[model samples]
Target: MSKKLLATGLAVLTLGSAPMALSHLVKDEAMQSYRQSYFTLIAMNFGPMTAMVKGDMPWDDAKMLALAEDFAAVASVDVARAFGPGSDKGTTRAKPEIWENTEDFLEKYAALQTASKGLLAAAQSGDRAAIGGAIKETGGACKACHDEYKAKDYLY
Candidate 1:
């Protein structure tokens, strides 16, 4: 390879890996906020989900459907990959269990995805019974992963 081409390739590789490399070393408040946002997304979804599963509310199907869609929007990102190797910042509430039990964690997460999508479809079809069933299954997915992976401090 030409010297210029080789140097360009190295530069591209470094830039691509920079986010993972710097996540732990950097103490920027913005990075902290971004990390917090992921947690917040989970919290936001769970709150409404609990009410729906318990039938506490009037069963506003449209609202639940909308939230399910929104949940999917945030669920797709793999923050684990973003953190790369350097992402175990002391501030990170994400448990090392996430890495250790990656396959199981991913399976549970996939269950959440499937359940949420089912919830949305059931809501759209105006099937209250299906909605309840999907909600319960989705809740199970969340709890299963949380029981094993998330930190105790965050659970309470």
Candidate 2:
């Protein structure tokens, strides 16, 4: 092919692919932000419960119930949606293994959702021991995912 023809073809190829690449970049950024916000919300609610259960904070049944409800509501969101392809590359601590081992990652996510429900039920029961056990179970569920799929460090 002529030099001019080669240049034209290269330009066309770049133009055609640029939009798709940009689209994925934008999507990945949004998903990363969404997942991070979800975890932040969960921590805000879960932290107090853990503190109360551990005696780090004074135990209040009403506050426990409220926090558990918020935790469950936040956990109910489909976190798998934020783990879509390309999201593993952005400003996120989500490990690339989440994409490689999708089934396992989702199972862990589901476990968290189930544990959150258990927590809320325990809170409603107004039994301190039950609430403590539920909080432990919920933390275990969170640890299962973090152990496998969450990275300790993120790339800037």
Candidate 3:
């Protein structure tokens, strides 16, 4: 089946199987707020790494590893729980299609998680070349998701 179809199927199965639990599920606003805070952390940590890699800032091994760890922690969050119903309609750049195309978003998130781990490992290895490659791949993963599921401007 197509990704969209698969995503739809999964959504149906999940909701269909958990009616009682979902009845009291967290509010969309809470999810949106948490997701926004998570992304803010991502930006805070990722910006310095990118700047260092791009030569806009001086590099430091200890700092790179610390930032990478912070990024990895954020990447570990289960985004499937964050983009639930109505989250797209608030103070976010998240596109509504993220909820509709859940499988695609999840796959993109998995890529980001992998890239984050690679960056952490690279930072620990203290090899500049490896760290550069890891940073590039991490950036690509982020851009891939943003291109598909994030708006360039505010929805509100």
| Best of the candidates, lDDT | 2
Worst 10 residues of 1 by lDDT: 24-33
lDDT score for residue 98 of model 3: 90
lDDT values, one for every candidate: 0.69, 0.90, 0.86
Candidates 1 and 3: which is better by lDDT? 3
Model 2 misplaced regions, further than 4 Å: 1-28
- Cα displacement (angstroms), candidate 3, residue 79, comes to 2.7
Any runs in candidate 3 off by more than 4 Å, and if so which? 1-28
**Tens digits of per-residue lDDT for model 2, 58-95:** 99999999999999999998978987777777688888
Candidate 2 accuracy as TM-score: 0.81
lDDT of model number 1: 0.69
Model 2 misses residue 97 by how many Å?
0.3
lDDT of 2: 0.90
Tens digit of per-residue lDDT, candidate 3, span 24-98: 334656776677777888899999999999999999889998999999988888766877776777677888889
Higher-scoring candidate on TM-score, 2 or 3: 2
User: If the candidates were sorted by their TM-score against the true structure, best first, what order would they fall in?
Assistant: 2, 3, 1
